[model samples]
Target: MVEGKGEAYLLIDVGHVLTHAAYIARVEGTARLAAVAEVTTTTAAEGGLLDGVRRATANLELLVGRQILDRAGEVRQPRDGDGHGVDGVVVTASLAPLLRVALVGLTCDFSLASAVRAATLPYVSLERTVSLEGPGDAWDAEDLEALVQEPPEVLVIVGGADGGPVAPIREMGETLSTAYSLLAASQRPAVVFAGNERACRPLEATFAGVVEVSAVANVRPSPEKENLGGLQGELAHLFYKRLGRSEGLRQLGTWAGSALRHDLDALARTLRFVACRHGLARGVLGVDAGGNGCRVLWVRPRGPALNWAAPFGLGSGLGALRQRRDPTAVVRWMCHPISWAEAWDRLSNIEVRPGGVPETEEDWDLQQAALREALGATWQGAVRAWAGYAEGQAVGEADMIVARGTSFTHARTPGQAALMLLDALQPTGLVRLALDWANLLPGLSGLAERDAQAAVQVYDNDALLELGTLVAPRGVLRPGSRALRVRLTVAGEERAELDVPAGSIRRLPLGVNERGRLELYPARGLDVGLGRRGRGGVVEVRGGALGIIIDARGRPLGLPKDEEARRAALEAWQREIEQA
Candidate 1:
């Protein structure tokens, strides 16, 4: 009757709970997963909420037997499902689709990159980033056309972290004022200045007549370190506007609960949680490749992409598509086989239900391809929209694949859909075998609700229809370099020689936690910051089904070309060799 040992535990992510996996374990054998459900509690309240969780439990008897039911028959099993028959319910207090944002920056350096990186995350969708450089660092009056034409939904004005260097930031302020002034009254933009707080008021008043302006703490308060964490929340607030108003997403938001943080945003927050639980960034990189985007993360005390542009993400140019109506150039990755007509229909459907699944494989394939067209077109269009100013300089396919668009419900397998993105953006060899979120929209929109961890767990263990994590790290990879051969090794096992292209990933074992940490190889550097341990050397990278990587991007990680070098590299990792 106990089903084995420990009582059943169900994580009732009252808010958008995607991957909240329920495990039943004793002080003995492995705690096997009893259920994994993706729940969305967007607009629902108390009663409606509890009912949702109850429905999620396929084991009805488990609930009745545990007396999780209350007076009016409400679920009170410790909202998080800590243990069966344990009076407490793991009712998480989370929300989704909080706000929409816009960014204004002085330059495209670390400051702006910080803003962009922040926007690329799960909780936020950077509406727009305003810069003085127009599109390039040397744009003329004509190049400023895009800034004038289509300003931004919100602006994150960033500069030299602190206010030390004022020239570039001031010029950017003037540029922002000028651009804001041009937009039609109804099309007025919003500005979130993260640069020198000293100048934000002036920029705010200067452009007050043009758009709504709000300012947050400087992302780069000082050059020695970068702070994009706050800005990430600010952007989530901005994106909330879009989520709240949209009928479809809004309804789903209700399921995810109020204030939704993007999947990436949730990951960022959880990263901190895991870090506090674990400690330090050895060589860690976390990736979440969803339908509309790709979020690559590595937690450090320095500058993260959220506060600036390290040229991160696979959906790099997706925002640029806001300028074009027919974004066909970049949406080619969804990879469904559909006709132009059906594609249009799917695109139309996607406008409202971005993750709608196609009933038939033919329809599914067509819609997926259409998704590529739509999102890709968005990427190209976003750049092209800016093309009015930055012209050819706009990062088309070059930006780290930051944004992606997909409707994954129709997916029959995990690798089938997500793997395409790995092939498209071509994750850097230094970091391979990232995650791909499907059907579980809450994972992307769970941050605002504070239910990210539960959501991530639900998706990783439950919605992961496909049970593989670290797919091999092969295919194309790039980070301003054209080198093939990534220095990948499994537990230092005779370092495997892989040849990834500019955009692709090899597969490996999936990881959950101690219960989820799939042990195939020793450790492929997928742990927290590349698995840095004190004597043990087990980098605690949390919540990835995919395996580890040996990235060589900016680090220029070595690759043994000749026999001697290969032997040397292998020897270097020989200490932590993978189990035979």
Candidate 2:
């Protein structure tokens, strides 16, 4: 407690594998991150989530030399006479199990597909989807029974564009009401109506006493407009309510005085703020991969689009990588050959002990390859969702890509981190890379609501670790052809020029705090974000520990077909970045 100018914040994020806490103290009218600590998340422990929170806070207390909790193990609020306590506590968690969901819609391509996109959000898993076309549509009684047996936490009903046909939606509502009447009061899942506005009131009436009914704005308002934020916000609210019922959350909520914030949403909003602050036109892309899932949030001027894949992450969700992508995708990135059996064994070990880290050199290689595959799957899913929801619009190129989670934050070096991002996301054009090393994005987000200037101060001064800027062309040149010829002039420093060959990545030494002027000349048939082949442009570039990296690897990043040749190529690229 710093006596009133601003408030101190103790932000805690309860993840599946780890419970992380950050302490941000306002000093001289600016928010400064004091310390960060993490411990194993113990959701099943007898003490509940409070136990983990207390442990993490205690660790922070040791680092900051201040007491955050009282003798009875309660968060000390206010000054506490000696000014040893914090002003307020902010909490966010991603430890809750995903809700089982049943999707019901009139059309598979429109309403149902949009519902599928909504279900992809964090904390909800699509358990089943039933499409009811019209009055003539036949639904199997046994299938309905099976769905009821599974007992979805929520049933989403969506269909019929605005001012579109009404009779079919009415029929579908009646059918759903009949199905709801068959289940006992305790077994019925909550119903969320996000279809035609006209049908919303009637649908709520249809299920009024039978079950809980929540009517939100239609997910797909028409063929061209998609209003998902209203529905997504509602779902997030409901999820927070359910999460509050947990023993761990119940205790924390009582102490924090506010409901726990959704970690992914908090991070997304923070990234949006950062991008807007910098006046970035291309917007920001964020990837948070952890034991439970990978959450991708892309925010542009148009709006923010999010996709949460519950089963595609580096830890417990690794199995989804194999399911959603080619089984050999991880192996393809590896220089040394690893048989499927060997890969599976390594993956199985990771799945069982998700918090484990790589020890040996072989282990590190396997982890990096596996992480790349997970990130790729996540990026592809997000892009597909953006295309569908944004009216055939695509994420052209992100101005900033922020990589979060343990895999990226704990990498051995900035070089390794840059290479992993390049290999996984394969971003085109010129882009800036940063990592959430302290896991402070959530904390900054929480603070933004209370003190925006403080939030931005901490972010720009203490939070994001700039991993340098990358310039990668979209098109490919002939093998060994000049992909990009560039002249880099560091501000108040010397200037240098280099010709980078196709299918290679080169790094120029530019330390952090130095800005450079770059004149880019791509070869014929190549595009470096700007249109037209061989077109040149001048742009300002920022520096990080790894400096400026130029990746000429063909879009889609080609690899040698022969085993030995592929190994040699992978080794050569690794040396250029990781071993340099």
Candidate maximizing TM-score: 2
Give the per-residue lDDT of model 1 (tens digit) for 1-580.
Answer: 1121223333334333222323322223322234334543323453444455555543433534444444554444443364434212223323433234555555667677666666655444445554555555544554356555655566566776555755566666666677656656766656677767777666666665566667787777766677776776666666666556755444433532333334444445544443333343332334333333333444432333231121112222233232344533323332332344454454455444433446775565554443334333233334433232232322221211212123333345443444344333333322223223332322323321333343444443443332222322222234324323333334345333444332222433334441222222212332212223111122222323333433222221233345454444433332211211
For model 1, where is the 10-residue window of minimal lDDT? 307-316
Instruction: Give per-candidate clash totals.
Output: 155, 0
Q: What does the lDDT read for residue 350 in candidate 2?
A: 91
Q: TM-scores of all models?
A: 0.48, 0.87
Number of the top candidate by lDDT? 2
The alpha-carbon root-mean-square deviation between model 1 and the true structure, to one decimal in Å, is: 12.0
Q: Tally clashes: model 2.
A: 0
lDDT by residue for model 2 (150-206), tens: 768888889888877777677777777787788888888888889998887777777
- Model 1 alpha-carbon drift over 4 Å, by segment: 1-32, 37-120, 126-130, 133-149, 159-187, 200-216, 220-233, 236-260, 268-580
